[model samples]
Target chain A: MWTWQHVLTTVFGSIIFPLIIGLAWGKLVEDNKSFGGVLAGFFIVGTVWLLNHGIGLMYEPQMGGNLPGPWSDMALAAFWGLFVADLLEGKKIELEPILSGILGGVLGGLLLFAMV
Target chain B: MNFRRILMGMCTGAFAGFGVFTIWPSSLARWNWLGGWLAAGIIITTGWLVNHYAGGLPNKEGGAWVDMALSIWLSALLGGTVVLDPVNGLIRGAYGIFHGANLGGAFLTIILQLIGATIAGYFLYAARRSDA
Candidate 1:
């Protein structure tokens, strides 16, 4: 019985974190077409999200929530689209970098709230 | 100078902090000052560690987009784990920020992180280029 919290954490850890990683960290280090960076970003985000949920258990015994599978899917899809756009454009988009992340994080938070 | 890398470390630490407070507001009150400092220290260390180890490699085979993507990805995972709750808590407590307080502020955080990464990357790229 994966609760909503579990789902939110997973989405944050897996999808959101990865997307951010792909965009931010990947931009800094990788130079090989950005795919590895993106993949690594995905992995890192997923791990962080999971770590947060795991940490939650220490404070509360019964964390509750349903995993928003569709939300997670949408998040992933959006990130990939962004990644592809970056790839085709031949550069990382000149976005207000921190602002973009903040927007993404907020959206993620809202999604979590809704799911919960 | 190495200062840029250190700066990046700080920036990443800050973002890590923001992420925690924003995502899990419930945990904010439990942590004290010491707890928060410990957490921030951990994230800074993690950023340094990642930069120290797997950071030298660049997206040489690809375009600028590739390089930036890799850097962001590395930071996100490294930042998320190393920063953890203690660090995140410390950050929020020190800064007096909260989740949903600056609800749509991730973009700002990301910009800071990017600035840090760019500085670090510039030096790293320069060093690597010199080496080759």
Candidate 2:
């Protein structure tokens, strides 16, 4: 059964796990702010999870059923972490990045679904 | 926000997405981690080509490329999740599978996709600005 405990676990895990991993990668690897991106990624996922939980509570009981599963959560969190780290280092958004990202995402999604 | 560029981008993205799925089905099935990374490279390259050709965007050397790759990768990852919903629905509907609606999940997914893409865009912008 889905409960508050489950929600709490999902949120906290999303944040803390990435935080620890990012920190470890930074400390042992290169000592960069890449960890911030990692944190951001999980933070986004946690926020989304929390939002889904709230919506579920307010509306239908199974409203959260369509939320991203664990694999997506981890993949997105990791990528976000890298992106945040780049931002902290003063990276700029350009037309190429924006266009490329959208393009990449569409293809990546198709590949993922095909695999599944 | 040029409509022509957006249309071109959509076509490029759709083609790349479908192409990767077709080419690497075996690798994707054998090892997810390696396969995912390989697909990331393909998608990023495709996105870069689209930007360069369709949007007239220029590329820089060094860490800038990494930043571009990362942005594209994450954006694509988020995009994949967003696209999957409609695709899944279509597939299910084709088979006459019925399920209750999860409005909360749908809303959250849209919100998350937007946030995720925005974050990626911000990073890309920052990276490019620094390069300039």
Candidate 3:
């Protein structure tokens, strides 16, 4: 029963707000000029929330249901926040970090689906 | 990509995933915006622990994030497919106890996490390819 309005709100609250905060943090704390933090925050939080919302919709109750709550969202935001800050701090991207993130995400998904 | 790092990444990811699963509330009625905050705490703590214990890797290029993001996205698709498709009956059956969620719905909820872990295994191969 969610219309475009609900979707838009979710996007704004879940994605845009985090992105703005990330951008600000990058600028103020990390002095990052490239806005890499914004992108990272957007990608990680956006993907996780969007996917969680989509899955929750498949069930009977669409609103909360099995979707992730603020706990997970804030966790993701903080992770990206530090990640972007580090990137701004001149931390080089390597296969290890990417692999680590991917592996962690997938495992989290599997555990969530199978157990929680 | 070093093989040792890949192994460590898998272990780290699994540990994080386990932590999320443990802290996440079982009932939908208990779920709210606060759950996101809780999940976030678990992820950050676990991630920090893994990085600290496993030995962080060297930095490469910004493109790595692009590749990682793309891979994570694609892996969600893949995980969704695996969960929803009828061919994965065993997995579906195993996961059926969680709120009686249909395959499609279940796929949506957990796709990102699965993709995150799945893509880590292929980082080495993906790194070698020019297109990646």
Task: Compute the TM-score of each model's chain A versus the native chain A and list the values.
Answer: 0.29, 0.44, 0.38
Worst 10 residues of 1 chain A by lDDT: A66-75
Which candidate do you rate higher for lDDT, 2 or 3? 2
List, residue by residue over A1-116, the lDDT tens digit for candidate 1: 44556444433333333244434554444554434434343344333433433343111121123210111111222233334434444554433332333333433233233321
The local lDDT score (0 to 100) that residue B72 gets in candidate 3 is 28
Sort the candidates on lDDT, descending order.
2, 3, 1
Best model per lDDT: 2
For candidate 1, the iRMS in Å is: 16.4
Candidate closest to the true structure, highest TM-score: 3
How large a fraction of the reference contact set does each model reproduce? 0.01, 0.10, 0.15
Best by DockQ: 3
Looking at candidate 3 chain A, the ten consecutive residues that score lowest on lDDT are A54-63
Give TM-scores for every candidate, taking all chains together and pairing residue i with residue i.
0.24, 0.36, 0.43
DockQ of each: 0.04, 0.12, 0.15
Candidate 2 stretches greater than 4 Å from native: A26-71, A112-116, B1-132
